[model samples]
Target chain A: MGRSPMNREDTTKNRILAAAGPIFAQRGFQQATVREICDAADVNLASINYYFGDKQQLYIDSVILAREQRAQQFPFPSWSDDTLPEVKLRKFVGMLLKRVVVMQTIPWQVQLLMREILNPTEACRQLVEDYFRPIFDRLLRIVDELAEQPLTDLRRTQIGFSIIGQCLHYRFSAGVISLMVQEDQREECFDWDELTHHITEFSLAAIRNLGSHVAVKSSPRTSETH
Target chain B: MGRSPMNREDTTKNRILAAAGPIFAQRGFQQATVREICDAADVNLASINYYFGDKQQLYIDSVILAREQRAQQFPFPSWSDDTLPEVKLRKFVGMLLKRVVVMQTIPWQVQLLMREILNPTEACRQLVEDYFRPIFDRLLRIVDELAEQPLTDLRRTQIGFSIIGQCLHYRFSAGVISLMVQEDQREECFDWDELTHHITEFSLAAIRNLGSHVAVKSSPRTSETH
Candidate 1:
């Protein structure tokens, strides 16, 4: 009885979000209008106010929804305690590559997030706190297990960034890389699974050797001859 | 006496380029105007036509000049046969870091090149051929010296990109990283020297151990438990 109206309300909100996501993704916040979103959703203009309160809220929700949809589609597989850090790392890196980079089509959310990276707003700050912080924490946990012993937060963050940097490079430099790679090797170069393997193995080798055997000098910059 | 005309022409052209580079960097190619470039150069607007012939030629010359200046500044040391691969690798990576990432103020040339990245044109293609291809080849030579056996082009490229990816991540994600790093460790986090050291060591460890001891499997993707 009471739940019926609530479910209807939920449906309308979701419909508005689905319509608004791509519009907001394509056009920035100021440019994306409530009328367009309502028209796209096939609802009247009042529906935008009724469902989302305002256009700004609609934009924020769309960005959040974009992240949530991907998180749902490619959720991380649950790993037990006995799982090797190496295996955990491989899975984590592979999932990030898949979610962010390896997709056949660039998700509207990615474009939306790219917009945020350029012009960070309140939503971007919230995203950092809610979404990215958790992922960063997850990476730190995995890196902790790989350390020879308990490592400093800085070292852990560096190792995590190293792993992340490799993954992100593929996404950012895809254009330049395409131009640089020979035509014959382009197929292998773009294959997500092959790339994941390479990045994983490369990072694993670095992590395993880093703390145990790194030959630090008095000043690393001074050692450079060039 | 013939050289006098050439010298005068060179000085005026250099002046125009010096002014135009920053304006193009600040305002992208489409928006940047020849009049503004000339005004900043303290030369009449006609000087743009007289020195570079056209706006397009001026933009191209500015892009090329950006690359040339950096090349001259951080040119790789001529290593002797006796220099260890470790030392060579350190210097190569360090020089790259110095050139791209480790700077007090990002040279406008960097911003100008960044514009090329977003909207590539003739200048970008020339950049890849004349500037980047040679750097890539140099990286291959360093990696070759470190390898146990002669590596394939793909392998060498992957290795080189891994190093480059680590370096570039800092520049592209500077804002996100600033937000992410904790307050107490902020200084070290942003320190270019410290960053260069970490990246160089992490990469060297990976390169040294990668082919020699990377335990290969029949199917790497299938081996992940998660």
Candidate 2:
């Protein structure tokens, strides 16, 4: 059990992060103000300064906290497990989708992190290295184990890019996706279990056929220019 | 030949769009000012108001112009032509990557548009339908022809989401990707031919496997239960 003061400190910091997540998600980093954050957290402005220095540092802390929460919720799978590669990949996908889609659990800090990705700042580079790259490397190792021809690191990286690309498009283009699919509930449509099943089946097929070195016989060059 | 005044007017509009694309890309919509746009275009601020009703409309028009230029450069294969599905898909991927990857293009507009999607505006809804839905629909039809399962409309929509997801990941996570991938020229690593080949092959494998309906065997539940 934690001491009373320690628990209070933890609770206060978490409350600030929880409040900041959605606001940062909605308004973005530059647009969001320190006063607004303090108000949202129901804490004095001094508390934030005391705990995390300034607004920029507070924002960074919020992101770090969210990232930690995500990791804890969806910890990296053990490589030693005897699970089939397909099943492992599917679970990974499901966990990822759930983390991204469930707004109640996810803080707005993630949305801010994504913003930095599209238009990066100096801070984003360190964030990526510390938090994101390892997860991808883990993903690549899993794909390599499953692939037919033993994917080169380069190829695995590309596949990783593709897998993530497919997953994130829904989050990035929710409005267009809703219109195209005729779904009233956009958030609901990104159902984790269902999407995980679909992508796993799809991505596994893609990886299985890769690096087989099979000759793709093209139609005779009609122009004969070459 | 066009009359001199009309030619001048067209040229001025083109110049404004050209300048605005880079400026808008560097600084997002909120930050990008009419004064900055006019300064970059080497025109009076009054010219922007004359050419397009206001700054918002000007930005939209600039994006449209960029899209038109992309369509011209990477014209879609004629549906009338008896092209192979794989060939068509590969070409489509190439066209999409080329269009989206460029620093100066409507693809940059796409980045701006993505920001709005995370935190939508009224404008995002209309823009989604007008600009983006049609693109997904076109891609879906191609996947439909290739997929072995006779995929339902919902499945096709999901697949469409995945394709876009993978393709756009580069722009979406540019900073992180550059750091993580061990390449000399980080940007140049997104090779169109290679990437398109991988995506097309991966998508094809996934589509082909849909016919089999082989469910992956599950592993024993992990100790860390949610």
Q: Which ten residues in a row have the lowest lDDT in candidate 2 chain A?
A: A217-226
Best by DockQ: 2
- CA lDDT, candidate 1, residue A152: 71
Clashing pairs in 1: none
lDDT of 1 by residue, A18-43 (tens): 88888887666767788888888888
Docking class of 1: acceptable
Q: DockQ for each candidate?
A: 0.38, 0.46
Q: For model 1, report DockQ.
A: 0.38
Tens-digit lDDT string for candidate 2 (B23-100): 775676678888898898888889888888778887776555555555567565454456666666766666677667
Itemize residue pairs with steric clashes in candidate 2: A21-A108, A165-B165, A165-B166, A166-B165, A166-B166
Write the residue-wise lDDT of candidate 2 on A1-226 in tens digits: 5435553365767677778877776677777877888898898888777877777887776667666666787676554478778767876666666656544444465566666666666667777788778778778877877876655555677888888777777666555566666645454456565576667766886676544532242322312111
